[model samples]
Target: MKTKIIYLLMACILLVSCQNLNRPSGKMTRVERVVSGQTIEIADRSAAVPVLEPIRLIGIQAPDIRQKPWGEEARIELEKLTLGQEVLLEFDVQEKDRFNRLLAYVWFGGKLINEYMVKEGFALAEPDFPNTKYMERLINAQERARLMGLGIWNPDQPMRQTPAQFRRQIGNRE
Candidate 1:
């Protein structure tokens, strides 16, 4: 009986290992909702909102809604690109943020959303995060956006504090 149990355990391990190997590093999931320019809710089922997980786009930070400069524009741009689309998510060293949102590299049509956002100038590179997998790529994209004067990168616009700085400043005021 002991031998039989050991065999069963081994079989289970092998099965799990094989399953993991078969699954792509970039897991396929559908976007149920766009929370903001930096975060999205993903699910397999067809739901209006999201019953699954909230995936935060890694390596970039979008402006807060209170920023008033480009916050709404960023959110709208993200929604235009991602709502109701199938996205593939690839996680880095860290899994989740302090907010419990899954930190990931979101992909759509073979393009990385994090990089795209930076490239489009809707977001800024978040260097403090441990997930620096695409930091260089994101920085490069941001530079291109800056050069091209896209989105928030336009020099004619008034300078606005980043989401991180806004959060910190708000905290200090309270």
Candidate 2:
């Protein structure tokens, strides 16, 4: 009786561990829309009912709305690449942001979207908090973009100058 009980307990533990391992470490889903240069909405198939979830790509930083002249173009490029396609999201360590948005490394048909954005000069490697999975890739991409003079790399682009520079140039005219 004692041997049987021990065997049953061990078997149960092994079964549970195996099941957990079998669960998808990463999931592939269709993107509903591109939210910005670094984020997108994906249709989640894991729930009992299907749902569209916003996934913030980890380890990359695209130009923000308040950034220099090429910010909008960066966003546009991202939209063009992933607006309506199926992508595979691979989770590394952290899963969600403070807003409960899923944080992931997005892959579209074997292409890594985050890395592509950086490589194309649309974004920079943003190593802020739980999103450091692809830091090396992002850095390399940024370097390449800078070398090729793409997007924000153009020196003649107009943008909102810093407050100090504005003050100096305007000389209290406002």
Candidate 3:
């Protein structure tokens, strides 16, 4: 009886560990809703009843809703790409931003969604600390977009400044 009980306890422990280990790691959950250009509600099973949490794509900057020019276009494009689809979220060092949003590198199917946004000129590389895994890729994508005159990259585009420059300009304006 003692041996049977010990075996049963071991089995239960192994089962619990296995279940925990089976959880998705570094994988983007499905997009439940698109909140804006900078935020999206992702379906996360880790919470009770698969709650939706806003995920902020790290290392890049998409236009803010209140910002000038292609802000709406950026949000539209993001919606078109990932409004109701499953995406893979890759994390670097920091997992969450100051807003308590999940900071991730989003991927849909086999495509890198974050890089695509930059390549399409809807976003720009905006690396923050250790989340620089895709910094080079984002930069290259932005360059390609500029070369191709995509999205906000047109020669006549008024807001063709880099994110850093844009922020500085805004500060100066104030």
Candidate 4:
């Protein structure tokens, strides 16, 4: 069983690394971990070696696990969509964040995972950043999700806090 999983992983790694690192579009990376709704750990291994890179999805912010149900839901949704998949990573003006995680728009199965996250109401559109590559799409999705009251936007539930707001509160408290 373990061997099969390992082989599958290796195959995915191989599939993603077939392109040049300097390609204009982006790196083809295999999703290794869904760290959160907005973050993931991807790998690009060439020559049968392993190289893991943490990635932060651009244009959206999902609830943190500290936010309870919303966070957990978002994480699960991301895992369902991207775990073990070979996703294409497209960059904008900013390549990486302060934490050194690659900032990108992730595509899986020809669909934009970042936009899907917002469309499902699992995340909020983040327009503060300059990328704006998929800004309109993200914003529209979030609006639709909000109108539908799906996931975190459900009216019956307690008011949910944005991950950024939570981070700020945590910083101030500490």
Task: Write the number of the candidate with greater lDDT, choosing between 1 and 2.
Answer: 1
* Candidate 4 segments exceeding 4 Å error: 1-24, 44-49
Candidate 2 ranges beyond 4 A from true positions: 1-25, 45-50, 66-69, 158-174
* Per-residue C-alpha lDDT of model 2 across residues 1-174, encoded as one tens digit per residue: 999999999999999999987443478677887777777887777799978788888887676644555566777887887788766788877878888988898877667888888787677767756557677878888789778876655555633443235446667665
Candidate 2 clashes between residue pairs 3 or more apart in a chain or in different chains: none
In model 4, where is the ten-residue run with the lowest total lDDT?
18-27
lDDT of 3 by residue, 1-174 (tens): 999999999999999999997443587467888876667787678777888888898777877654577778888888999988978887878989998998887888777788988898888777678888778888899889989988777777745665556677788989
RMSD in angstroms, candidate 4?
Answer: 12.6
User: What TM-score does candidate 3 get on C-alpha atoms?
Assistant: 0.74
lDDT of 4 by residue, 99-147 (tens): 9998999988779999999998899999847788889989999899989
lDDT-wise, the better of 2 and 4 is 4
* Top candidate (TM-score): 4
- Alpha-carbon shift of residue 163 in model 1 (angstroms): 1.3
Query: lDDT score of model 3?
Result: 0.80
From the highest TM-score down, the ranking of the candidates is: 4, 1, 3, 2
Clash counts for the predictions, in order: 0, 0, 3, 0
TM-scores for all predictions: 0.77, 0.68, 0.74, 0.79
Model 3, residue 52: distance off in Å is: 2.2
- Residue 124 of model 3 has an lDDT of 73
